[model samples]
Target: MEDKRADVQELSDFELYVYETVAEIDKAGGAANIETLRNLIDRPEEDIWAALSHLVSANHVHSTAKGFTLGPHDWAP
Candidate 1:
C-alpha cells in the first residue's frame, strides 16, 4: 500500500478527531499520552497510534517526552 501523506485539512475524520482530542487535552493542561488518548478516544490503541503518527508527520501535532502538543502550524483561532 502506498503511504501517501495527506494535508492537515485533508486528514481523515478519525485523524482529525485525534488531532482535536490532543489539542483539547493540551488546552485542559493535561498530557495527551497514548494511555490518555485510549481513555478518551473510543478506538483501538493501534488506530490512535496511527492517527498520531500521521498528525506528527503532517506537523499538526508535536510529540515530546511529556506528551502531544500543537505543532508549528496552529489550528487555534
Candidate 2:
C-alpha cells in the first residue's frame, strides 16, 4: 500500500497542519470534526473546512459517521 507521508510534500502548510491535527486527535483516541478542528487550530471555520476537503480528497483523511480520521494508509504499515 502507498504511504500517506509521501503525499505530505504536496500539501500546503495549513493543509499539512490540519492533516497532522486530525492524526493527533485520532492518536489521542478522539475523533476530529469541523468544530473540534476549529477549536484546536486557530484558523477560521472556512479555512478548516477547506483544508479538510483537500485532505479528504487526497485520501490522507477519511470522513465517517464518527468524524474525521486518518486514512488506512496512515495507520497501516
Candidate 3:
C-alpha cells in the first residue's frame, strides 16, 4: 500500500466530529454551547469539550460563558 491515509493529519475521532459540528453550526448560524452543541452534534460531553478546546486553540471557534461561537476571522480563507 502507498500510505493512502497520508493526507489525514491524525486527528482523533472526536476532533473530526467537533469540526463537523462547528461547520454545521457556522452554516446554520453561529455559537453553540456544551448542551446545544451536544444536541446538535449528538455526541457525548467529553468529546464535545475536547474538540471545543482544540477548535478554540486553532482559532476556528471561541468560547464564552454561555457557549461557543465561530471566530470572527475564521473566514480568512
List candidate 3 stretches off by more than 4 Å: 1-10, 72-77
lDDT of 1 at 64: 92
lDDT of 2 by residue, 1-77 (tens): 66453367789999999988999998888789888888889988999999889888888889999899987663532
TM-score of each: 0.82, 0.83, 0.60
State model 1's lDDT.
0.84
What order do candidates take by TM-score, descending? 2, 1, 3
Which parts of model 2 are misplaced by more than 4 Å? Answer: 1-6, 74-77
**Clashes in model 2: which pairs?**
none
Q: Which 10 successive residues of model 2 have the least lDDT summed? A: 1-10
- TM-score for candidate 1, residues paired by index: 0.82
- lDDT at residue 54 of model 2 (Cα atoms): 87
- Whole-structure CA lDDT of model 3: 0.65
